[model samples]
Structure formats: structure tokens, C-alpha cells
Target: MGAVINQFVINISLIFLFMSLTFYVMRTVLPIQRTSPLFVRFWFGVSNGLTAILLTINAIELGEARIDLRLIPIALSATYAGPFGAIVTLGLIFIGRMTIHGMSAPFVDAILMFIVFFLFSLVVSRVLINRVKGYAVYIGFGALLVLIQVTGSVGTGVFFNVFVPYFLMLSLGAWLCYWAAKKLETHLWMFLLHTHRATIDELTGLPNRYRTLEQMNDLEMSGKPWTLLVIDVDHFKQLNDTYGHLAGDAALRHIGQTLERNCPPSGFVGRYGGEEFLLVIEGSEDAKEVAEELVQTVRHTMFECQGEVIPMTISIGAAVAGHESSMVVFERADEALYVAKRSGRDQVRFA
Candidate 1:
């Protein structure tokens, strides 16, 4: 009866440890959602489960001796999620250790390990690591880990050979994981940059018509209402004729920058076509405030070249989204812009 009770308690402990380790591994491997595809998510889940199984086997081999497997998870979380994720991973590990072994020397050791990983990884993510400047981070992390373990050994009076070898092994593993993560992160960043550039206008740095339409579709799908404002620069041809095409280009660039800076937080600006810009505004009932702001900003802008302050004013037209089709919205704004131009230049008119 005594032997059966001991076996039952040991089995229960092992199960709990295995489950905690499994959680750690899964969180590390799971996709961050922004960058991960469905297949990649599935594969990460599977790989983490397998790793948990291996860790469990190793624990059994060691006669259920307490080992700090926390660092493996922390290292992974640091590499992917950066400092915050590393801290969360560390907390999970600390909680896991306390549950598995209670408060003792080993638990203290585990807490120290978490702290070291959290601080070092925060440094790596913030200052030392990038695609080109990343090798230094790996070296720094490895050195930091070595210093921590050496200090820990000194304090604990543990067998030097055993602790030193294990520390070195873990450091090597951390280096490998960080290197892999850095490579992945670099590729992901590049992918996002390329995607953004493809969907954005080169001159205005705003989303192109395609991207704007895509966003509208997405918002519509998600049951959100939106409004569109189409703006046209009045007498753009006059500027080209008066100051030459170069000055006209300069004017466009200036206006693009200004509009980008001044648009509301829920607004998106786009370069729709030649001398024409589009804006998507959400939850804005009166486009008058926006229209007035643009009109004033454009009227006051002093374009300087060769110490000459060249002045220009723009006529703007605005339209809301739900009342019409995209084409109709643009046509209405264009009509309104014509009204502004006809009424007298340098004004905003809405339809």
C-alpha cells in the first residue's frame, strides 16, 4: 500500500511537470499571429509537443531530479517576442519551478536564471540586435550566461565540472536559437517592407488605390462604416506653366507631406492619381473641419527655392463613403472641387 501511494504521487508530479514544460514549449513555438502562416503555426505546435516529450524522457532518466529547463523556453521567447515575452516566459518558468520543487536552493537558482535571461535578452532586443548588428548580441548573451553560471557556482558551492559543462551547453543552445530567430526576423521585416512599398505611392508615400480599396473592403466586411474624401489640386497646370514642372513637383511633395502630418488619427491619405489625393476618414460626420484645415494649410504654404518664396493655393472637394459608390464619391468630390475652382480659387467645397 505504501509503495503504491509513493508511485501514485510520483506519477502525478511527473504529469504536472510535463504539462508545464509543454506549455512553455508551445508558447515559444506558436506563431506571433502577425508573421506566422497557418501551416507554420501547426508545425510549431507539433515541434513543441515533441520537444516536451523529449524533456519529459530526460527528466525520467535523471530519476525526476530537478533541472532548470526554464532557460530553453526563455531563450526562445526572447528571440521571438523580445523583452516582454522573455519576462513572461521567465515568470512562467519561475512559477513552474515553484510548483514542481517547492522553495529551496534549486528554486532560488531557477529565479536567478530567469532574471539573468530577462535582463540580457532585453539588452539584446533593444540595443545590440539587428540583422547586421546581431552577432554581437549572440556573443553578449553567451558571455552573460557564462558569467551568471560562474557566479552561481561560486555562491552555491556546486561541483564545478558539472555546472560549468551544463552552463556552456545551455549557452551554446541559446546562441543557436537566437541566431535562427534573428535570421527569421530579418526575412520577416524585409517581407513587410516590400509589401508596404508595393501598396504605397512612391511620390506621396500613401496607400495606392489598390490598397485603399482593399482596406475599405476589409472594414466593410468587419461591419465598420467609412467615408472617403477626394481632393484635386486646382489649376495644377498653371503652376507647371508659371514655375516649370520642377516647381510643380516640389509643390506636390510639400502638400503630400503636409496632408500626411495633419490628417486625423482615424484618417488615411492616398495619392489616387495626378495632382489628386484621396482620404479615408472614419466616424467623421462633418468634413468641414478637415476641408477648412487643408484649405488654410495649402493657402499659407510658402514653397522656397533659390531663396525665393513661391506661394500656391489648392481647391479641395470632399465626399462621404456610404452615400454612393467609390466612383460616385470621387465624381461628387471632383464636382465640388470644380465648384471651388469656379467660385474662385483657393477654397474647399463639399458634396
Candidate 2:
């Protein structure tokens, strides 16, 4: 009995180690924003399959029965990755059990136990996913052990002396695995939020200068035909001085929204700094025409702040990417912007 209990302890430890490795890979290696349905299914399938294989190798033998932490993977996968992942995990465990036990009565009993657990997983997956740290999870684990014992051909004494210890170990193991996964998930979310904050403008909710420059680097690497448009709000300081900073901020926000709304599918628009914006449009034959449309849109649209209507105009400079670098093109666009401002603002100039 002591040996059996020790074996169960070993099984639990192994299960915890394997589960930690699985989550570490998920947290660090997988690409963010690319966890498609197929990818989730495949990832959970493989990870749970490995868990089952490990459990089979380290299974504790008690007279005519075999026990392991196989249920942890199934339970975690079902609750965390949904029904599809659960089904794949179940299939893998069945295959692993068959490989270990062969075609015998013990194998048949194992199959029955797995079926019972699978049904229970399906019933409680949604609840567990939402709340896995409560008394409900403990109760569910107890019920699972009861069902497995009743379904198996083991005697009452064996159930108490052997299976009960395994049940306790697995219950603690499952809770620990779930807790670690939740922590990693929270950390991932916070990391993504911090990354987003770093690359986006606070006021306009548009990509900031750093993110725009990163996109420019990507465009440069692609080596495709693209146009850069440098836009400046005409007489922005005067507008701010006359209407106050609040009105100026409102105007900038209005312009940002308009540019975002009118931006082409193949174009990127970002807040470049105070009263300035940048645009990157790909494969546009008439870049000046698009810039003119933007100028007209801003010129005609009325901005209201404190119940006062304010009209605004923008000067734009356009430059197409040639053999010159993105920064060189940007400089040329800035030069053209100066030309547009000198030739009378509220117009577009090409370089």
C-alpha cells in the first residue's frame, strides 16, 4: 500500500512537470494573434497526446489495475481548449491505453472509465473554463473518482486504498495545472496590452511615430511601389491660440478619425506628431489624386467644439518610393510639403 501511494506521488509530480512544459511552450513560442481554430486544435492535441504517453510509461500498477495522471490532460484540454481539443485528447488517451494494456478485461475497464470521464468533461467543460478555482472543481473531481470506481471492476477495498490516493494526487495536480495556465494567460494579456500601448498614440488611438517607422521598414523590405504622404494642419498654432488647446485637440481627433475612415485598404495612416500625420499607400498610380481628396475632405468637414463650428485645411506632400531609401523619400515629401505651404496651403505637391 505504501509503495502504491509512493508511485501515485511520482505520477503526480511527472504530470505537473509535463503540464508546466506545455504551458511554457504555449506562452513563449506560439505566435500571438495567430491562434486559429485549426492551430488550437493541433496544439492541444499534440500536447495532451504527449501527456497521455508520459502517463502510460509511468503508470502505477496495483494488482490487476493500472493508474496514472491521464485524466489531467483530458480535463485541462477540455476545459481550456473547448470540445474539439477534448475529443482529440480523448482519442490520444485511448490509443495510449491500448498500447500499454493490450486487448484484455483491464483494457476494457480502462475504456469504460475513459468514456465516463469524457462524458463528465463535456458536461462540465464550460463551467470549469469559467471558474476552475472554486469548490465546484473539487466536487467535480470527487464525482469523477466515484464514477470511475463504480464503472471499474475493482473491489471497494482497492478503490479506497489504491484509487483514492491516485484521485487526491490528480485533483491537486489538475488544480495546480489550471492555476499555472491562468497565470500565464494573464501575463500574456498584460504583455500584449503593454506592447499595444507602446506603439499607439494615446489621444488619437492611431499608430504613433515609432510604429509608423516600423511599418515603413517593412514596406522598404517588400521593395514594392509605395507612396508617402506628409500632411500638416495649416495654421494649427493659430487655431490653438484662438480656440484654446481643447478645441485644437478636438480638431486633431476629428482629423485622425477622418483619415482612418477614408484610408484605403492597402494604405496605413498614423499620427506622426503634434498637428502632423503620415500615410503609406501601396500601388496607387494617382497618389496626388488621393491626397487631394483627403485635403478636400478635411477642408469641407466642419469641426464643432463648445458649439462653435471650425473650418480646417491641410497641406500635403507626396513622394513615390524609387531607388531612394524611405527616409530620403520622407525628406523629399517634407520638402514638397514646404513647397505646398509656400505655394499657399490647402494643396498637394509631389516630389
TM-scores, all candidates, are: 0.61, 0.74
Q: After superposition on all CA atoms, what RMSD does each candidate show versus the true structure?
A: 9.9, 5.2
Q: Which ten residues in a row have the lowest lDDT in candidate 1?
A: 60-69
The alpha-carbon deviation from the true structure for residue 16 of candidate 2, after best TM-score superposition, in angstroms, is 8.1
Clashing pairs in 2: none
Candidate 1 residue pairs in backbone clash: none
Question: Across residues 234-264, which tens digit of lDDT does each residue of candidate 2 receive?
Answer: 9999989998998889889999998888888
Q: Candidate 1 on 1-351: residue-level lDDT in tens?
A: 364334434433443444344434444343342135544433333433334333433442122232323344344444445556555545555555566667998568657755776677656766644432444453456456656666744544353434544455455544554455545545565666788788998876778878876765655555556666667776788878988888888778887887888888888888877888877777657567887887788778777855688776777877665644567666787788788889997887778
Q: What is the lDDT of residue 217 in candidate 1?
A: 61
Against the unseen true structure, what C-alpha lDDT does each candidate score? 0.60, 0.77
